[model samples]
Target chain A: MTTLTENPNVAATADTHHGPAKGLKRWLYTTNHKDIGSLYLWFAFIMFLIGGAMAMVIRAELFQPGLQIVDPHFFNQMTTVHGLIMVFGAVMPAFTGLANWMIPMMIGAPDMALPRMNNFSFWILPFAFLILIMTLFMEGGGPAFGWTFYAPLSTTYSSDTTALFVFSVHIMGISSIMGAINVIVTIWNMRAPGMTWMKMPLFVWTWFITAFLLIAVMPVLAGAVTMVLTDKFFGTSFFDAAGGGDPVMFQHIFWFFGHPEVYIMILPAFGVISAIVPTFARKPLFGYASMVYATASIALLSFVVWAHHMFTTGMPLFGELFFMYCTMLISVPTGVKVFNWVATLWRGSISFEVPMLFALAFIVLFTIGGFSGLMLAITPVDFQYHDTYFVVAHFHYVLVTGAVFSIIAAAYYWLPKWTGVMYDVTLAKAHFWCSLISVNLLFFPMHFVGLAGMPRRIPDYSLQFADFNQWISIGGFAFGLSQLIFLALLIKACRKQGKPVDAKVWDGAEGLEWEVASPAPYHTFSTPPKIK
Target chain B: MTRANLVLLRKLVLVVFGMFLFGFALVPLYDTFCEITGINGRIIVKAEDSDADKVVSDRRVKIQFLVKTDAKNEFDFKSNQKFIEVKIGELSEVSFEVKNKTSSLQLAQAVPSVSPGTASLYLNKTECFCFSQQILQANETVVYPMRFFIDEDLPEDISLLTLSYTLYQAQSVQASYSKSELDKGAS
Candidate 1:
């Protein structure tokens, strides 16, 4: 058999030449999935920073008993825009970028199934976010209604710029749907021969499921936003009480899409963690088949539990009970996945590598978040907790500590593999410890304040909740500042100055990706690798 | 059958099973589709404007806005030039002014169309805004009335109307951006 260099294939040929120096055209008109993925990752990182700045503002305003930094109205807008940016602009796209970079390498495909559609998806995000950000300058300011965009709030009393918010959400939904389609089609149709479905990596499997969820629910979100626009501007009464339409019906539709959207953010993280945990622990993933089934079950149960968000909006007793039970049922599968993660690390070579450290924090912290979620699932308790800082704390724990932590962990885990150089291990661990401690400091007290009868989305609170708010603000600033260390670690890794990494850095990695060379290549496994 | 045929058969079974699963998944969605699109139990309320019923409460009278398209100038409210009615369209808003001639602090809520009862707008207590709650501090007189018209697409044929208001003490739930609040802690 001829060597790669002797045969002179595209990858070997390109390696010989300097090719084009990285410049503007290399970004704009490129079809390289890795290049495109890097672009997406950097874009999401910037949006995350912007969204985090908004969070800092929100925390600053809420630092004391009375409104200290901003008016209640502007605070409301900050919370609204923060949720929108994080959900649509940051977490989801970050996962998609990871998928674009890793999935083809993992599954032994040369490129995504629909590369041009992939390009369209990535480019649409910047413009979509631009439109949304521009709405802040519109007359009467950006959407002050909460991110849920409940009716009567988003409708009758909305600012004139609600139309822009609606259209921007439409573009974002389109971008997500197309990106998901690319991921799914590439996985289903382009997997290298012998890479059987059952033998595929968990990251690919979880992402496959996530892509399906995106395609299914994003359209519903689009439909919901379209109705909002029409109701506000075009005089449709889809949500007008005077027109025999109930305002609460909008919540029903939005969360039907939204609850799954939450799953979309984390399912890929589940895949990433599943892959990384076993690699570090030196154990086969405990209950691999069960992990796959559990993900599917979580995605399925996500649909029936949307109304748990609307429990306090006054549904009938039966409706409340149905939603509560359905919401609680999700814990079964979620519990299975969590149990498997711990089981993988049981009595194995458990090293606190930077990626493993973040994953470990995610396990403990996300479980705390999950337990709070179960508490919130109880309709009776949720009534007391609804629209309170407690609910805010619960989701931030799930989202920030859970979803955001997993993204950071995945970044560290793959940074060496992606760059062919190890990251600053000491600095990486410091970032993790700081994040873990500060994030808890930030979100933990919200439970107490919320339980003390403080409602959410308010700029000020009663004097009783002041001390916890002060502690929480300190934690928020530390958490925000700690992320700067991560940015530094990433920049250092891209410079490729650490120890040289092997093709498979971890001892027990069992995927097609680790079987390939480090730093991957512009094109890899073009002829498809044999799975068995 | 050869091994190839066996593999083909398994693939066929899996495809069929997937189809069944997908079809099962779609049943509830089909139901939700019907519910959202009004193919299922949907109720629509329409207003038929006939004429303004001049109801006299205490010592003053109030005129309700007419939602009738063909009701030919029944109420003599001052904004009649802007009031156009449709046979069967949306509900329109209408209001009339009543003087609190007595030297007492008077409060009122501009209660309109009882079927959907109460205007959706947050009621602000300002001196002269047309038939919302007018709280006149003593020895002061203010106009209490409604400012609304019918949604121009009300159903034709029915011709009856009732406008009601209740006078009571008012408390504020209005959350507006104050300039001081906006500039809070800015120094």
Candidate 2:
């Protein structure tokens, strides 16, 4: 339908015939999706380490209760920035990076539809985060209002850093929107001649839906942060209850963007797991159509369930029930997904490659997170679990084991394709096992402490929680160190230290990405391959 | 990638812009939603131009006043009368005494909420100090007046309604009231 289709061979020859430009300039000025993809992945890894460092501070402070290394205010900043960095900087970008590296290849298309815009999106993230990080050194030490940044705490009581925090988040939102738009346009217009809708890879499918979700919600987040800005600096009382605006209203608006924003993080992981599970199991994904429908349903349900986050905000009885039931409804489709994954593995020839093993862990751990989420969705019980360590444990399971684990799986699954060599299996497996065990050690007891009435986001706790706190801290440190192993594996593979491999790196691998050469070339599918 | 797909790209851009506007739209939308559902406990009733259709029922509901202030607020605020009994749908009046013990011009904003939660929808205030900030000159003691009527539709199971006002001291709260009229016609 475009000039790219006019003379496919010419387009292929022109872009692919030349090798990548040299040095740092390739990364600085490049529009190639693969280059941009690598940039996003590496940047996210660094941010992960930075955010993880903050978590270490939090765990260390909580290790034995009463004020130790850092003061309470600084501890608040640690929690706030840690959450902001991990959600926005690490997980979201890593998934987008995956989308960039893999989507065009999987769909047999030539590059993302708007490659230049893709570069711009990936580039802006570091600067946006810099603006946010700049806040810590500012007068009041960053936003201590928690990542939720609820009203009054973010407004009347916040330090001068709020303006900078708002601006940083705005730039990040812009990057996400541009990135999302490019993904949507590429998937919509650039698929190969015969790669019809259903035949597309599950990763491509999940990303397409996620792109729409990003477009829909990122602006809403922009709106939320802007209100926070105006309330603090511009003398607008959009959240000040004394000024005809209710603080509780901010929670409603924040979660409206917030709920879907969460799905945006996890849905891509769903697609990643969908791809990895079947490949290792040597079976077509069971309930394929149901999986698609379930993803869509989960996205739809995300919009309605935001208020469950605000159950304790004194919302009307009806609203609490409505949101609670809506949240519970999400588990239905989520349950469908888990059953489908297990069904795909039923008595099939399954091998525990690193990717498959991570995917399996994701299924088990994310389900635990989901079940806890279900428990929280009950309006009455949520009153108990609302801000406790239980809530912390619940999300870490989903985000770490669920989203982060899936990302690690995707990275391992495609590493050979990207690097043209097989990474050291023993080292990778060693990294995996260490991470799996330590992560559980780190997060599992959070449920007990949380359930035992230990509130989250606090610097120190009473003597009763001191024992659980120590074990949880140990887990936190171990999990943080284990990520270093994955980094070494990545660095070694990138340096081409592994054994060389041909196309179709894994024997059970399917789809168009596997059909391409190992190392994937500087350009992929410049001439769209006929599907069928 | 293609001409037709460029059209899709354009539409997606529109969706992004539209959702941005929708974000702003949620403020008014949430206000409307809460107003309709009587959730969020936001008090937004204007002086009714006319409630001549009101019916005064025989059912008696005791209205109690609860006042609270943040740590910084040292001003003395309390309803002069501890509690008052009013028939359902009948207009009733009560007075609150606010003593600005602090030695400077202060803008005090009072936020109101009703207990039993559902009572917020039925408790209509026609004239109240919470309608706007009460500006008090140094040590100016103002006894503010409030008038209200409970809707006849007040459910039978509720007999006691607690109307609470939370006082906040602010240097400025998004308005500029004239100093000359600060104490006009108040006791």
Candidate 3:
């Protein structure tokens, strides 16, 4: 108060200095949402690469039916750790990183509602993943119980380093919860005047719902892992039948969290697609209200459908019917979303930018994944698909093609805004086509082999599955290599090698984010912009 | 960041804590749900009926016995008769011989589960060796007896049921152990 009265000009000058700081401290100690967002994106990408490499090892081992590159145990570790890293370390974090960068900009807030909390959440992820990866080198190797880590397998037969895995997952849960709280608070309070609930961008709306899902389920995951920890180390039998508990309860509790978790990874992708599809098509989205409701409905139905994952786990017939029907019901809202995107593209001036290409692929492939999920929801049919490569193929289409591809799309969509330079168009196109073909090749064959009775998480397969496995491995390698083009494109954009882009880099792009200068000023909308 | 926002923040934090407790609550909640729905195939004891002497002699049902032992703990477990045909409402007895292959004293328990899950409600155990821990001397073999009956009310469509006992070895079965409220791995 005294400074404003005695030296008003000095206070004014300090407030006007909005450029970023000079060195590594700018990232390490800064609370700037953009810087922290960059940190998270980089961390997620690195984790993605590590997880993808593990997938490569898995595919290589499966290439010829007999273990060639790694032992069976190591291959189990690869599959388990690969799942853990991708779900927690790659897809979830990438969505969060995008929220940090874009949410405040969309809502016209100067920064995240709690900037320090943002930094804390991002920093813990690397450490948590480090602890998890460290277990691979420890005795007994990493978790071989698969990512689901069901009882008996997780409890009786798990590696000695199970405690480390539990603690690492616990850390991730905490980080996610804290990150979610920040998101909810930011969107709830920081919208610019006149930017009412319905007026907010689809990205912001999806994130708001996703934040709730995070808060609701991440704790359940923590509880599940805690039970696993106690059952193994503390002599408790939360999932042990001999001790008056049942292992089937583990599946119930886990899928409660796990099912919503599946949506948490994809809901934001819905938001990204909703935003991009309209921008490229040059159409004000076909069914914005329905899209929001659809996202909400999908989230709500997620709780009831968790048991669909456990259909073959031996649930009662009624339970099976209920879950199967509920799982299929999600398709209703999901179909609404798919329809909205297609409708937006109908009779519109569509241009296929790199982001649009990924978005279009996301819609088609995610639908395929959704359809397969529906197929598995039928209890009797799931018995056939359970533990098979078909299950593997289903999730990858949604995750790699759905959630992951959307993240890549968002990055390309906004990279010009964040970097002030365009990414190399030709290289990006090549990256897109190669990824499109290879990703399909990688996941598509798994469906065939899965249906043909090839169980997943095995290092060796029968002679019959040999050909499809070869094609799958080749596809996996190609997909893995294709990502390098992305890495190169990103490096070039960051170096400002490409031509500069003005604010509103895309002709039809619309948002507060584009109203500011390219490479958005370090402190934007300092005085919140009015929506009108 | 603002006063109203802080309130929102506080409420969200409470939701986080509440959800954590809710996760733990699901344990008991699950048990209660399973008990009510009979979804998990937990065998509930039935009242001794005076009419139980009327074993439906003409109608035949097959009882297949299965024992599951952890491969880690070297042990031999076998049902004396792999299967037996008994009339509905008939009392049947089976013996399982288990030997502790390990050289030290070890504790073992068999958790029984009925398959075709709905059959769990139709079957009642007169005496079964579960819940109570079985402590055997080093390399000792023990034969445990189980007595059970298929209730006359068992569905006509089902003629066979598998009674599986999953054998587990623990240092101890804590006295604090209680039946999980509702669910069993029976299915």
Q: Which fraction of the native contacts appears in each prediction?
A: 0.00, 0.68, 0.74
Tell me how each candidate scores on DockQ against the true complex.
0.03, 0.52, 0.62
What's the TM-score, to 2 decimals, of chain B in model 2? 0.80
Model 3 is docked with a DockQ of 0.62
- Estimate, for each residue in B15-89, the C-alpha lDDT of model 1 and write its tens digit: 434533443344346435533432222211112222433222222112233322111221112323333332222
Q: What is candidate 2's lDDT per residue for A326-389, written digit by digit as tens?
A: 8888999999999999999998799999999899999999999999988989999999999999
Off by over 4 Å in 3: A1-18, B45-60, B72-76, B90-106, B135-145, B179-187
- Worst window of 10 by summed lDDT in candidate 3 chain B: B178-187
* Whole-structure CA lDDT of model 2: 0.86
Model 3 over residues A1-532: C-alpha lDDT tens digits?
Answer: 1111111111122345655555565666779888777777877888999999999888888889676789888988999999999999999999999999899999999999998888889888888999999999999998999999999788978987999999999999999998999999999888889889998899999999999999999999999999999989888988887677889899989989999999999999999999999999999999889989999999899888888887777776777888888888999999999999999999999999999999999999999999998888888989999989999999999999999999999999999888888889999999999999999999999999999999988899899999999999999999999999998888777767888788899998888999987777777788999787
- How well does model 1 score by local distance difference test? 0.73
Which candidate order results from sorting by TM-score in descending order? 2, 3, 1
lDDT of 3 by residue, B89-182 (tens): 7777889999999899888877777888778887777666663667888999999887777887788899999888878775545543563421
Better of 1 and 2 by TM-score: 2
Please provide TM-scores computed only on chain A for all of the candidate models, following their numbering.
0.96, 0.97, 0.97
TM-score of 3: 0.93
Whole-model lDDT per candidate: 0.73, 0.86, 0.86
Best by TM-score: 2
